[model samples]
Target: MGILVQEDKGLFHLQSAGMSYILQLVNDYPAHVYWGKKLRSGSNLEGLLNLGGNRGLDRLPQEYPQYGTGDFRTPAYQVRLEDGTRITELKYSGYRVVEGKPSLPGLPSVYVESAQEAQTLELTLKDDYAKLSVILRYTVFEHTNVITRSVEFTNAGETQLRLQRALSASVDFSSGDMDMIYLAGAWSREGNLTRRRLVQGGTTIGSRRGMSSHQLNPFAALVKPETDENHGEAYGFSLVYSGGFEAEAEVDSFGMTRFTMGLNSFDFAWLLEPGEQFQTPEVVMVYSSEGIGEMSRTYHRLYRTRLCRGLYRDKERPILVNNWEATYFNFDADKLESIAAEGAKLGIELFVLDDGWFGKRDADNSSLGDWVEDLRKLPGGLSDVAQRVNNLGLQFGLWFEPEMISPDSELYRKHPDWCLHVPGRRRSEARWQLVLDYTREDVRQYIYESLSRIFSTVPISYVKWDMNRCLTEIGSAELPSERQGETAHRYVLGLYELLERITSEFPHILFESCCSGGGRFDPGMLHYMPQTWTSDDTDAVERLKIQYGTSLVYPVSSIGAHVSAVPNHQVGRITPLSFRGDVAMSGNFGYELDLTKFTDEEKELVKEQVANYKQIRSLVQQGNLYRLQSPFEGNETAWMFVSDDQREALVYYFRVMAVPHPPRRSLKLNGLNPELDYILEASGEVYGGDRLMQAGLALPDIQQDFVSGCYKLKVQE
Candidate 1:
């Protein structure tokens, strides 16, 4: 039995007829160094290899040998030459059915196929890279939460095979509503399609984009990993692709990327030679309760009993507050204490004192490694404040830009040779900081030991791991020039190892990855931390637009959105608190403002939001996420998500520009059980199902009165 399924440790598990293969999916902030684990990161795939029952590998698995494809994983198809060489490939037929038929042959068509409980596809990797012959597999409904006892294992050499190949799949959707994750480099969108400019630091590398059927909204695009990594060794070390919002189509205006034809991604490709076999990447389907629906969660609690870990405590997470936005680089312990005290009053579950708490960090310009408490900044010592915050009925968290160092710091001071710089050429520096050479065994050990030591002393429940700068002048001081080019790849491996060590040690601690704002936020990084900070700009108005872009791919629970101040700290925009809260409520809701300065009215508003979060959190976080209006494209945006039972629904509507007494604004509400009679609670309005949607609602002269409204609807059985 050859099978690949999503597992608990942020990856899909791969198995063969009689051999083993390890599959790990990681979200890397390519700009920042990769985080912990005994992982090896290839171009398109990364993470520790599960060579034995429970032991992890030092690098990502290159090829799965159990299968005949020779590559890590291919599709259901395979090929063999007259000379007995197997060729795992599929030539795209070029077109697909528009309403419900197959392609007309050269029209360039794509889509994924999935039933109620499973999704599967195939591919041919004969172009771009070298030696072919492969097979890929994906179980549609089984996604990211099964391991052996649920985890996938690695198979060294299981057959007399000869060939190399690649395979992968992405649930192709956009990340418009996601927070802290930014494509800040270069980006553009056309129709329901958008492309992110893939830049290393400040330079452009390549861009990846997707286009789907005009009328059919699938959750994602599943294609074969057919990219040529330029070297032409028949190697495709990496690729990250996606599918769609299978649970909630209405979250993004009901326009979904449902599924695609193939599982085309990075890890799917691999190399197999003499005495080797092959394995395919796993596939898993995800179902939730809050925004999309709950049928999947309640039904599949034991998704991967063999390979998956973590107790099934599907309860509400703690309400945490982060200080990254409140005080970027200028806050002492007293200042921190003030912030933490206010958080306690609001009943926030955790208090995270972000950057500047370590080293000689007075300005945004220096000292990364001085992990010890800054006595100069906090005369009371950090432990004292942690105790106080604990006394205030809140858990504590701290921030660290551990992967970086500054020219004005002690770590860099002691080892100028430790920075990743070219021998005689000047290196690029951001925020007056340089990245630490984690490739060195000594540097990796120091950072890991320091963090472990600090965590042992503090009762910190979370760690806001922020990487503010991207890599520049990439090269290592220790590695030979031959593998110097491997520096970028090696840096990522180092990062994964560090994070692996941290998380394994502090299994209870919550970790966050932030690169300035959302730059490093991706599925590659999500493996370590469950969620990411969506972005740094907190203006509600701007956020509505920004979040629209983020929500395309990510789920609401994964976005780090917060309610900040007016004349927003980033761009000066004073939006109403109500608007801010309504938008922020769309994601992992939190606040990044100085709570002490909030007026009593604002405080009351905060209390209300907290309550609202409690009431509808299950619906928002777990339900199928939908997008009703294009916050970016439409004049007025509206979208709603309904639970499977159809008893309750949450609809968010925003009027971007009010029309001057327009004749009539037609609103077509989707996701409704059209036959059932329903009532809109806010207006005390009752109308037949079709008319309420087709005839639409007459929005008042909203420019002066209502900007946005969340309507709750109840359906009569």
Candidate 2:
């Protein structure tokens, strides 16, 4: 649970709750020794650095390898000197141990409330010829098997240096016999878990699309082939970054695997003047001996409590109903109020007026940067509608895409150079809008002032911050020629600054981030906004896989799930209302349909669904999740949440499509106190915890497609 420095043997051991990460300086080069199950202090760790004689740098497990060196795999960093050479070697200089984690300047990272929560090790390496000093930072949590790594580069030389590649962290594993698992999908179908065997070559997953594109997530995991939900070893690496990122696993001919992750070096170069420093975003690493589930739970707890901040960090999220899918751009004040009225009757706690509320935005092409309300739609502006919804006993929320500007908008017309584009280059647009040049302080200031005016005037309780497009031209108007490659990373940094200002100024507002749904759903955004619209695809069947795969890394509390109208807006799949409610309840419950159109029977069912979710919302949000079955495997999907005390449990089971003459099945639960007796609320049957976990409970024999069931278990009194 602390960092140990064995200077005599040049070994540094960082031990967390269930794992140990040991590294050593061999011949003045830091080399990875071991990272796995915990090892006792004073053990013979030196023998673990078993690099054989003929110690070629290529075969050594380096803590941070460099290019042009004998290693020659993927360098953690690369710098071009003033002499125009890309060759440099760094040697271990000094190191220090700190009591608490230090925040990365101008970046979002996992934070600590107290000094006792974690310990950080700062190891310094110096390329004396280039006068560049690299400080590698590693922090280990005292209570979780989580280690975060980041790197800081300082230009100590008299002349400027161009950094061609400066990745955050890298690790080398002795064995490449593992399976690579990553989340891959696009748009409505985000977070599809994909796995493959690690081959004897470079395997990479990343986003060159500016925002952490929905095409791929900034995460990857390596696991033993036998690893499943509950057993075997797994190592997870997730970048706390939102922009372009590259994660690679290179298996060398020697069977060693080198895993690296950081800002994508593609079209990226930072010019560091003398005495200037550049800090890379942190990469969170988790290790588990009890398989992928334990690794996920470790990340879940750490991220939920530490990474995400503000008023909503520990509070229960409101049951919100957003009007996007219900009315789109056709809604006026009257229509919005009517929707809010019906939502209030159904016990919805918040009403979100998503997109198309401002500046002639009847469609996505216009009025993106203009924050003023359209007089034609709302005669009295946002105040009128916010108050109207508030009168209906619902908290009011508004949507804004502050990072984009439409060509037809006043902001863009006044300052055409404000968007990301190279001079004389044709600007490309997506979703009928161009990405704002967030690298400029003036642009960020204007956006801040615009939103601040509304927040000050309106009674807004929530904000759905959306970015509908990715960076295309990848050039900032204000950056110099040498720094043009820095635009993509600078845009992300500027966005973080704006987000920090807005969220800090309005701490009471619950901020939910969206990038046309799950496109920018990464840890960096979660630091300012507590939750994210998991995906725009609200179809219960599609969400079964989306939410299940997302739960592998994100906590349930940070997932924004909603029950939309059927024929679901995205997929047009007509599913039962009850089934929709069952699936959406597993996350922060919400509705995304026109409630006024519901039938009388459907209204009653909606009321019951709301009530049921209210009774178990706390358990679902904060409880430990145990996945029993995966939708990826077959027709059935099952998962459950167990309270910390193990006295209360809520189980959800879904049958996507009914099978003809199916064999009887029972769900065996996990994370239960095996010695206790429990009462199943659904059937009024009492059973022993051991029996429920071992023998299992019989699933209902319903012969209907898209059918679902929810059960509550309470310890018998």
Candidate 3:
């Protein structure tokens, strides 16, 4: 069993593939002891508990801290009674170890393939004073060193209770000098990996933008001072939520560090009536003693296999060409057909007609909620364009911004209360769009049914589900005054509901999530939609950093990387077409350029890029990834993909600048079978795996900026 209970020590030790999570009962409260490398003995806790006893309150690590506990640290969970009392002291009740994991209600969670592959521990604690019970769920996988945790709170008293704070998972460490690493960016640039020392007070990063905005992702990491990509200890935490969330790391006066992840505490309150319960979203935790690279690999493997679902989870994504950047709003049925024709000629498998095909929408300012086809753009409707593209030997895809409503549209005019707004308050708009109040059941049904109808009628093999704006007004007319604060969390729940319905109803449609671009890209969205448009910025130079940072926790298969025309649409920096292709090949390879406008030489280059991508698609999509060099640290970036069987590998290296005289850069490969002989496909050079990993391969010195190369290696039997 992966989960074992130490009766004598009163500890629940969860042993995953290469990690151990220890939870001990301190006096009565469940306390987290250690969560790093696997423990061979219980000697580590020799004096941890007694050390805190002299401080009056046992400062022993708490799984869920609360106020009035003598400890002044921030509580992991908070609740308020009917009389306005907001204190809770929960004691360990009992626990049950099960063979398999249980699915979280109305949320995206990792699944267990079989009972033999995983084990779950359901630990229950009771606050007898408040008549409340907290159930902490933990699941450990047998093959992957990942443990997922979530919380469920039940009100057993006769009075109605209000949950002021409910965090999914919390980890406490008695040590100091921890570094907190997170991702932060804006629309055109998402997932900029950042590292900072863990300071005192609260260090919080999250999104209150309804959708997990591009501002801050819900994933975080806490590492020791010596931690890096390939060394030391690091603990990674990612909330399996796509909506508003907060990841907080706080260092208390006692020099103890605690990390918590859950619903954003800002304006987030869930009302729980007696006999009712509230379940927080799940959080995936990975502990890597072998460094950040091991942490990334654990997350990559777990999410790729357990989190992301459907036909696209393990299959090669189609080499797609979206029409968003190519023609924008100027394209009509003829233009789309022409683009699809060119894409088919270039061996592209998917043709996505983005944005302008919808009702009265020539630009971004109108027709957002109107699902009907724009007769001006496509005389025969979206179905016609889909069929036209399908006839060109390409899978047809359509763009949809179903979450936004333009006030000037028919849906808004018919139901003025459909969009989120505050009574007598001015409604805020972004990109000239208002968010549909999905917290309303009617609104959710309308959007889901409308899109479902389109998917059923059109031959659409793919759907680019986009949300172009953040939430504002922050008020829901549907809820009462007291429940107004519940709007944000409720909105997220409604979104998950709508997504579940649509994806379940239209199982054949490949849904790719987009928020402007990459705004809502998180584990929660990946649960329903396997891939996300990495970013709206298609510049090769910019994407190198964006894709590299995103791949820290997200797998390459989940990132939507496309070769766009240069000067790129966002940054307007024109690089060589080959550079764009190489950058895009690192992810779900695709193109966003208008192929019809390409010159003869560019067209031939596009064809070659497409053909070459096919040769490495399987390896890139399913293989183990290794970050050889970081773009954030130097002028060059390098990464490699090794097959699961260690039989083949593909390495990508990019040089962003050219120096007058540069030093030689050697690339070292990882995760290869050391005893095997390997052959490089491009240069036909043969070397032993051990030699390649130890001595490293010398990369050719290209004297041009933005130049890249791909090296494919296969084991020589």
The reply for model 1, stretches above 4 Å from the true place, is: 1-314, 663-666, 675-701, 715-717
lDDT of 1 by residue, 615-682 (tens): 77777765654565665565766666566566667788777556676665555565556666777787
Off by over 4 Å in 3: 41-54
**Each prediction's whole-model lDDT (CA):** 0.50, 0.93, 0.88
Q: Point to the candidate with the largest TM-score.
A: 2
Q: Give the TM-score of candidate 3.
A: 0.98
lDDT for 621 (candidate 3)? 86
Best by lDDT: 2
Question: Against the hidden true structure, what lDDT does model 1 obtain?
Answer: 0.50
Q: Per-residue error at 625 for model 2, in Å? A: 1.0
Please provide, for model 3 over 1-717, each residue's C-alpha lDDT reduced to its tens digit, 9 standing for 90 to 100. 398787667888899778888888877778887787776655655334545345544366788888776767767788889999887888999999989899999889988788898999999999998999999999998877789999999999988889999989988888768999998999898889999988887888988888778889889999999998889998999999977898888888778888889988888888888999999999999888888998999899888988888877888899999888889899889998999999999999999988888778888888888899888778898878888888899999988998899987999889988889999999998898899898999999899778878888889889999988889998888999888988988888899999888888888888999998889989999999999998998899999889999988999989999998877778779799998999999999998878899999999999999999999998998888999899889888999999989999999999988877788878888889999999998778898999989989888878888889988999987
TM-score of each: 0.64, 0.99, 0.98
RMSD of each: 14.7, 0.8, 1.4
